[model samples]
Target: MYGVSTYALHSLPLPAALEQIAELTDYVEVMDDGCHYIESAEPLLSYDLRYSIHAPSRSVNIASTLEPIREASVRVIEDCFSIAAEVDADVVVHPGYFAWAADRERAKRQFARSLAHLSAAAEERSVRYAVENMAWEFFFLQTPDELPLPDGAGFALDVGHAHIMGCLPAFLQVPIDHIHIHDNDGTADTHSAIGSGTIDFAAVMATVGQNGITPVIEVEGIDAVRSSISAIRPYL
Candidate 1:
């Protein structure tokens, strides 16, 4: 699954966007970070492109302390599902982010409830629900053992984020059905291409092998993203 985040394809016409990366990859993630295909596929989305949707993020966390923001998160995910259905893509969702880590306990409860809502909506749309683990967040799908992840609930691991949080061990343990591959400086989320940072790329691959998991790289822009894939190709 050599998929690049379409956030990398920002602002280009849909056909031009698809043509730009067509030769380098096969799958794509329709990130709400930049592009909007609300009215039509333009041209690229018109193709039989395999897709995955990264839900709207940033301050749109489902675990917000405020009720309105939390509800908004659900509607946002619902919109993502509608788009996924249009593109025939699976959906990748972040349960939501908390502004402060202290709210983690309450956020956990909120996430559980939110997931239930998302799960039902997703099931109806036939969209896959992949919850992502973050680099700096209140809590992760903290443990694989904790959740009642029905038949379809899966995980999207962010490897560089794992290294940042110093959760390498736990990161290796989760059932990785999907991933957000990127690199970051220890101090911040740099989103640099793989091998540009201090992470042990080979060790990360070995861990993936050990766990029988395959994770796609989460990157920005096509040129840099293509390079990152090459850098990690040997291990992959």
Candidate 2:
């Protein structure tokens, strides 16, 4: 029912994107630091955009074999949480990634440790955050049977990523609080419109309806994102 993810138009510069947010939507997802730095400024900027933070995706990792990277990941999330505090936003973050490593147990441990650290940081500031189910990543929380979620944790069901992860229903079984709806091809992750790709919209929407989860569909550019929102408007 809400508009598209602002991350769809992330290629734009921060100020330009802020201007677009000023013109286009009310609930803007401040998906990266560029947006955060602008939105988190003091003296109250002119923008009326209500925000939610999505943690940045970079070379940093919470599930890293190196302690420094893990520490860096924690620091990055702390920065995100700080920005959330500044904007009074709910921060959303992917737990961690384990690429090229087939070690599930090690990944699980790293994710747990990272969540534990960030969870404390989030609570100290009383800023809310959600754990997202990422595609083809090393996080155990993607699949239901893979890892256990912490008590205070929430879920973000990325539909496109779920298709790639092969765990939509399993993820649904968990107590989902929010959803990241998108479409993509079977082999590659393309954030397309709902019906434009291979994802089953009817079944997924049905499952979401049955479970009472509302979705925020993600897409590419502003026009395509608007079209996807229009397409799903009737159902919502």
- TM per prediction: 0.83, 0.86
**Model 1 lDDT tens row, 69-159:** 8888888888778777777777777756566778777876777777888888888887876887665646555444544454466777777
For model 2, residues 1-236, the per-residue Cα lDDT tens digits are 46446677678866566576556567667567443344344422456766676777554577776678888988888887887887787777777766656665676677788888888998899888788777664555556665457747667777787788777666666666667777777667788777777877777777677768556656777777677776676666
Model 1 TM-score, 2 decimals:
0.83
- Best TM-score among the predictions, by candidate number: 2
Report lDDT per candidate. 0.70, 0.70
Clashing pairs in 1: 181-218
Alpha-carbon shift of residue 203 in model 2 (angstroms) = 3.8
Question: Model 2 segments beyond 4 Å from truth?
Answer: 33-45, 99-103, 137-139, 206-214
